[model samples]
Target: MSDSSFSGFVQSFKKLAVDTLSIREGSDPEATIEGIKKDMTFKGHAAWILIFSILIASIGLNSNSPAVIIGAMLISPLMGPILGIGTAIGIHDVDMMRRALKNIAIAVVISLVTSTLYFSISPITIEQSEILARTKPTILDVFVAMFGGFSGIIAGSRKEKSNVIPGVAIATALMPPLCTAGFGLATGTYKFFFGAFYLFFINSVFITLSTYIVVKYLRFPIKKFIDRSKYRRYRSLLIIFLTIIVMPSGVIFMNMIQETRFKIAVDNFINDNTVFQGSELLTQKIVYTDTLSTIDLYYMGKNIDENKIIFLNEMLARYGLNAKAGEYFPLTKKTLVRIHQEDGSGADIDKKFAEYSNDLHSKLLRDIYTKNDEVIRDKDLKIKLLEKRIYNLNASKKDPYPVQQLNKELKFQYPEVEKYAITSIQLQEFEGDSLKVIKHPVLLVKLSDTVTDEQRPEYLGKIEKWIRIRLNDPKLKVYKF
Candidate 1:
């Protein structure tokens, strides 16, 4: 382990690292500049491509289709001017920076105008999910723009550029914000216009700034302005430009994080606390600002009382998301509601009426159900009694009281009949589409002495008519044996 060998090992390791990680500017400087300048040009073809891309992106955002959005991103010429601006700043070329800026302005104006015109007559005014997703620029969007810019510059500087440029274009999402802004303008909503444009501005500025950092780090030969003061002035301007671009986004990201935390905490609180049995939370809204922080929830089903609501409020305080100034009491100016409640707005009146109508309908159904049960019970009792009586009559059917009465009447009247019997006949009757077995009374009579047909007929007729009247069935027929 002599000094020479140790130094040799160290140098060898350094060489290996450099070979693995080194990114050289192999493309000729003049050739590279020429290529960038070509892209930076605001030509007719570039303008048409940007316009068509704007229309495609606007339609995609309007429909909330991610695939269409990616297609638009791949075909967009918007990235050229933006990258040109970054490359100019990276090499400290003021004239190139000016040209890039001018081209970028043209691209932006064309994009905005094209999208606005498309949205104006397209008849789809409703904002889609994709459109809304671009309205807010978060800290994550900042990171994405920075990384995309870094990748774009690295790929562009290489002698043979790969598909990384297209990937950066899609990941950075440069076109969507402009188109979303157009939708907002068409719909007469300044909120969308401002928010989306802010996001687009962030992407463009950060991408340019990232490219400048890379170029400076790579130590690309500076343009070397005749006036050193001009170089310092441009450097200072770039710093100020980045600072101004990033500050608002930082504040916005912090607010977004706070809002996200509030939403998560509120959702957990609502789900964990059983404010009412079978209660369902329909909506939760939070208004978080320096002066005011409040959570409003809308729910349906069984409502929780004030005491339980107060307990739930205490839970919100535990999460450090809510601060209470006074005790909550119902019918007071300030109160906390853990269930279906209103702030005395006119909208609550309609809600109350709907609730009242639902209650009335439920009560009416309950009453009808009770009446139906009583009617069914009474009818069941009558059927049971009739079945019991029929069973007893059928058991003594051979010589029942009705048979004895018939015999006594026949013997006292003419003494022509000897024996008589009563039996039931079960016959299948077709009632509508159904076949039913029905039970009916049948009388069988036997004469003691020999009698002619005419005399037999007279006796049978008299007995059958009498039995028919007693049985209350005039359709009864008699048989002589």
Candidate 2:
């Protein structure tokens, strides 16, 4: 390529860069300031809008609805005062700064108050995941707030209004934290109040700082205040705020890292120090929130003091989880076993073995005895039930049926027969005065009132034969009633 052609290409790229990067070119600072002031005034319509937006956000958080939260963010007037504060600080406008601070205070108080009232009245008391998520602020929130503030001012300075402001509101998420803080207030869970409020504070402060930086970068004309010492306090207050907000956020981030590291260390310790080869590590419960960290491991065939206990103490120190020498060993008792170990002090081991063996033997004997008793009881119950069944069968056989299904069938077949009954008889007699009896099952049937009167004897004979055939006893007896 020719040098002239290369220079022309470079110039074209530079022009593109300048055109893309220039924010002040199309921006009117005075118009932007007036627009922000109009937005920053929190009274009448703005106050009502803020109040309603807070309620919507509270409902969203309570119901775990992300879409509702986004709607609330879009309608929220919170970004107005926050951006106003940022702009005021950026341009060194003391009057605007005072107004911005006052308006922001009003918005915050109203937001917190409105949300608190709504949450208190709401029937859904359980903390939803959406609300719970906002309670824990991370470093990511810092970036969101800063970027949102920066973009907000850039968009505000433009000649044509865009969707960027609403997008920033949703991205910064000012409403959710306030609603979450309200939840904490309603439920008496002060941690939620502190954590969520801190998140909101972080978003607001960083956003204001970003606006200040952007305005300063744009080199907009600064407002000269009449009282220098009074305005100086504002700068001092900003510094104080930076210390307060940044310190806690940094501390929380560090604690989160520590907690995560503690979990990994615990997991590694368990995986590496399984008591024996074929032993399974079932589950572990580790609490590392407070100064004293605890780990409870559930497993079988693992000896505590040999490797586990000593190793756990070492891990706590290695991972900075605050392990004590003798007091804070991981496991105190075996998870699934009750027997004492034979730790090879000859006599002591023997004594422990003896006790464990005796206990095992006693338990085995008790179980065997209990099982035997159950089996015996079951057999007795079965015998009683069987005897009762036999008695019922005998009784049923001897007595005639009170309402006979067979008689109904017979009556249907032979409608001339008015009534019918059959009783089982044991055919028995004394043989040659020997006082002994022989017996056979014979069905004795009685019939009465034939419908045709002309066939009584004939019907009786037919019925007797039918009864004998049906009973499977040719020796069945027939009688008239």
Candidate 3:
């Protein structure tokens, strides 16, 4: 291509980019400033709306309902004063800034008081996931606030308004954190209170910063002009404030990333090392922390040998999970592998396995319901039919009893025993004129001729105890023939 043609193409591309990205084309700065001023005051309808939204948000957080929280966000007027503060800063209007700050202070107090009252009286006082999520502010939330603020200001300045402001309100999530802070106060959890209030502060500062940037970029006419020295001083103060606000979130985000990576590595290690010859990996628990981390492996069927445990520990180094003698490992100081094995006594092992299975099942159902509620609502009948079919299929399956293994175990433990048979029997009884049938397991054993009649009762008692404990059945009967 010729130089002239390339230059022309570059110029055309630049024009297209500018036209597409520009927000100054249809902006009404004067109208936007007036509108912000109008909305900045907290009184009458706005005050009542703020209180109602606080109540809604508190209830949503209490119940851990995302939909209800979103509804509350839509009606929240908290963003008005925040935008006013940013606009005031952009135009250098000290009066406007004072009014905005005062109103925002009032709004915050009202929100905290109202939410605290609701949470105090609310029966469900448990810390829900939704409330807990707002207590941590990361760099990702900073970006959300920034972009949401940008969209909010741009949409507000436009002559033809759009739904972007409400969308921004939801994205920034300015209401939930306040309610969470209130919950923390009510419950006397200082950690939650400080963390949630810090999150709210982060959102407020970043949104104000974003709005100020947009307003200055559009060259909104200043209400008061100051000397360059004073302007520079103000700018420097703003920069310092922003830096202070952002530093903690940056650290938090880095920690989150490290934790996420560690978890992925742990998962991979578990998957690769799960295939042991005689043992089965029933469940695994991973606890991660900056100071130390631990991985607990629960197995059944056979004990893992020392050599295998040593090898697994050695493999941890390959995954960058091993503890170094003198190194600053921020993700974790050391990764400890604790192995739990099922012995001949099956109660503890069986109980742990059952708990793990139940937890996994509950998590699966929660995820399915949360992510597919709309789809499930549309096909409720189909889902019910499928559930019924699943229940029937499960009911039709035979009870999982290893008769051959139990027989072998019986023979090994009792040398004189030749064979054994086990069966489930129903006993019919009449209780207050009503007939009841109860099912119990019956075990029958055949012994060798060397076993005398005197030893029969003792052997029966011992065998009965063994079978009952092994099968986890209290109502089991044993007979010797």
Task: For each candidate, give its TM-score against the true structure.
Answer: 0.64, 0.59, 0.71
Stretches of candidate 3 off by over 4 Å are 305-307, 323-330, 345-481
Show model 2 residue runs off by greater than 4 Å. Answer: 1-15, 221-237, 274-282, 298-481
Tens digit of per-residue lDDT, candidate 1, span 1-481? 9999999999999999998877763534445566777887768888888888888898899787899999999988877878778778667688988999999999888888999898886645666668878888877888999999988877777777678988999999999999999998888988999989999999998898787777766666678545779868877997898788778788888777766665566557667774455454444444455344655665544554678777776776655455456634111122243355433333343354455664644333233233442343243333454455555566556544365445557676647678877777888999999999987667788886776676898878888888788778876778976
Model number with the top TM-score: 3
lDDT for each residue of candidate 2 in 1-481, tens digit (9 for 90 to 100): 9999999999999999999998878777888888998998889988999998898888888888999999999999888888888888777787898999998898888988988888876756776668878888988789889989999988888878788999999999999999999999989999999999999999999999988888877776788644779768877997897887788778777777767766676666656654544333334445566355566554433344555456555544444345446654332211121123323333332343446664644333233233442343244343454455555555666664423446556766666655555655555566786665544444344445434457666767887787767766787666666
lDDT of residue 383 for candidate 2:
44
Q: How accurate locally, in lDDT, is each candidate? A: 0.73, 0.72, 0.84
Q: Highest lDDT: give the candidate number.
A: 3
What's model 2's overall lDDT?
0.72
Alpha-carbon deviation at 116 in model 2, angstroms: 1.2
Residues 240-281 of candidate 3: C-alpha lDDT, one tens digit per residue: 988989999999888889888898888889988766876766
How does model 2 score by TM-score?
Answer: 0.59
Instruction: Please give the lDDT score at residue 379 for candidate 2.
Output: 41
Collision pairs in model 3: none
